[model samples]
Target: MDFGLPKERTSLKIPPALGEEVQEGRVALTPQGVRELVARGHRVYVERGAGERAGFPDAAYEEAGASLVSREEAFGRGEVVLKVARPTLHELALLRPGATLMGFLHLAVAETGLLEAMAEKGLSAIGYELMGEGPRRPILKAMSEIAGRMAPQIAGRLLEAPLGPGMLLSGLPGIPPADVVVLGAGTLGRAAARAFLGAGASVYLLDKELSALEEASREAPGAITALITQSRLERYVAFADVLVGAVAVPGERAPVLLSRELLARMRRGSVLLDFAIDQGGVAETSRPGIYQELGVTHFCLPNVPALVPRTASHALTATLLPFLLQVEDDPLKVPALRQGAYLLLGQKGGHLE
Candidate 1:
């Protein structure tokens, strides 16, 4: 697709993700995915070692019809940029005016200054989270499913630490399994419930939507699904050995479901893992990485899937390739672009809407 000027193919760029040194994971496109895009007639420039951390060697990309370029060249040559995370202000500044930037723009937690920078640059920004509404948001669903599957594994490890409950999440014969409470019934929450169940934990899945709760129950036959209410939430929180907050709103900040008072009522050394931290968290006490407050250990990693970048990159690449192929047209007007993204961006003072 032209992406901008008619009859002109879009020049795409991929830069190496910056999460390696920082210990946060984010390389989201695989070399195989890149090959598919190139096969569709678009030129793709990948930075040297862009997918290295994600287990994709430079030679793989080279063989995939991608040109290996320096960091500066990757940024300078492309009319359209695709990345796993939002670019730094310095990276954004390198783009030519009106360039197209696509990635997961965590608008709610993002600084206003960055939005202003995007506006000043007149860049057309498309967020992965807002690519489509409901089931049409394939990117969000794919990533969230991976994150959900990882949640239980992460919580299981934390439970064995000094500050954890010091018990096996999946108990043995004649021993009671750990009690897991998953808040929200969306893709992430359902995936978490299934994983916990598979590990032999007794899972309580709660959500405001009855339909969502029903779906969770059907998906995980043994899981207990209940309509979330203040009393039910308080009761469950007090009894839970592990609490997972996976609530999300497509284009807005996730609502804080666990208040400080609610947190204080939980048992000491219990674990609270908030998968929703990327959008400002669903628990009042949740923060990025690990922390402790009210005697409860909170594990809130914004990019949980980054912990398994190779797998994540493959899934993300699958969802992104179709969209990339359509870039020859005006992507901003593509019906698949979630309208709520425009709402959120406009609300954040961006000019894209």
Candidate 2:
């Protein structure tokens, strides 16, 4: 099908992977997206049933110009591997030497042993979360929007009967709706605020920047926006029915904003949901917990967007497809693809240039 690459060009052996540990949705590349690469003179392999749980059947990939293969073959054949989550230790061993791996590396939280292994094996790795800075992160923003929108829904579920306080997020006439507090005015915080507001809850959004706080306040009429200070945040915590920690620093660990004492002071039936847990979290106790503790329920899954794999996969493909095509022409020479390569491999080895 040749999408204009040179006749003598080297094809990119790309394979899309299925997540092994994440019980929910995790396939990032869709069949339609894979077909785009196939049409561009790149060979794409889809692991058998990789996209099934994400609503893509094997036949769909076959029809979309992808070669369906076993997981071992998918890993063995590809010089460049695409995935949504970080590859496990076992999966890491399957990679061909010097293979390029791209996904949400979450290096701050990644195991030292794993990083060392990749170094020793001369593997090139790129992190989706750090691909671009600020709003420039098209892929990260798309997934963050999904997570933000789901924040209110997750909080609401926690407040439902048997699960939490038995209170509704949206109250009846003459009753007050839940108070939803979101930390950070970034893509994630804004999305969370909008979702909670749409559900008829009063939203309070806080950010370190005055410009951001003002922007959020102006954009969301009737919702409160405030500068983030320890005192101000602590006071708000006492009044919040749902506290969502979505604050993050690109390529760095998230700052801890809530202390145990402040958390204990929160309303007994309140919900503490930390979306930044994957980045070391924004609270002292912000790890995933099944049972509520400290008089509050905590929801701290690192891959929240993976809960809706189909939607996330489509969003991912939209952002990643262009780059995949660029790589086919000349992976090492293309400026953007080169940037990605350096980010993964560093200057130590594995095609840093």
Candidate 3:
């Protein structure tokens, strides 16, 4: 079988600075990923200590045939820039005009200034979150799986005293387990249901679509599945010890499902983990970091996987490598890549939908 590999490979850059305001330890390309790109004859320039936070030393990247370059050279010389988070304004300024940028560029919820800057630079930007067609989001799925699996542990810790009511997620032999209400029956929700179930919590998974709910039921047999109705949501939210917001809408901001009025009904000291915060969150009160609002502890960090940088970086590398390869030549030729092009060269906004 003839795999259509590009005859002329492109120069790729991996920068050290994370795009988000918060400290993100995960790097876009790992040493292993660089090795594969180099094997295919691509030139890879890695910024010094780019993968240090993710536990991949500079020596590993060097062994993989990546040139250790300064930040300026990495961003200035590459035809394509690979990043883990959306580029901050400072990092965005460093990119050469018309360079292709591939990363988790959440343009839907991005600041207008950032969008304008990209357009002014005439850059081509591809968002990993918006890459695939329905149910085919490889990069998003990998990150969501990591975030979902970590939810139970984070919630369990938050449920302890000082931050919470000092309740155990598993409860005692006679005591009832904590109720975990997971919104959205998508990949993250299903994974969260399984994790919460394993943690001995009573899991209730909800979604607007019956098909998604049915799928979640099959994936997590013991968890209860329900259609998200106003009455049902109110009842569940009122009693929920932990409310997890995993809802998402591809290429758009996450719809606000829980209003302040509804959130106010939750018991004092209850926890709310809004995984959808990256897409503007599923709750009206959810913000882009951990805090207390309306007597509820809210954990709404946009980059949850950054907590486990080593694992997250490796997983990201595996899922992103194939897409990176396809874009080396003509990105628009690939259906997924074309679909993910939020901002095309010399344009302010490409196809968002």
List the candidates' TM-scores in order: 0.89, 0.89, 0.91
TM-score-better candidate, 1 vs 3: 3
For model 1, the superposed segments whose C-alpha errors exceed 4 Å read: 1-25, 133-135, 338-353
Q: Could you give candidate 1's per-residue lDDT for residues 113-206 as a string of tens digits?
A: 8877877777767788878645578889999999889877778877875667787989999999999999999999999999999998999999
**Against the true structure, whose lDDT is highest?**
3
The better-scoring model by TM-score among 2 and 3 is 3
Candidate whose TM-score is highest: 3
lDDT of 3 at 54: 76
lDDT of 2 at 335: 48
Query: Which residue pairs collide in model 3, if any?
Result: none
* C-alpha root-mean-square deviation, each candidate: 5.8, 6.8, 6.0
Off by over 4 Å in 2: 1-22, 133-135, 329-332, 337-353
lDDT of 1 at 180: 96
CA lDDT, every model vs. true structure: 0.75, 0.75, 0.83
Give the 10-residue window scoring lowest on summed lDDT in candidate 1.
2-11
Candidate 2, residues 1-353, lDDT tens digits: the string is 11111001111111122122445455657888878788777887778777877798889988988777777767777777787777677777877777777777776677667777777677777777756433387778898999999987788878876667899999989999998989999888998998899999999999899988777776677778889998999899999999999899866788999988899999887898899987888888777543477988877777788778789888988887777777754354444544444344433323222
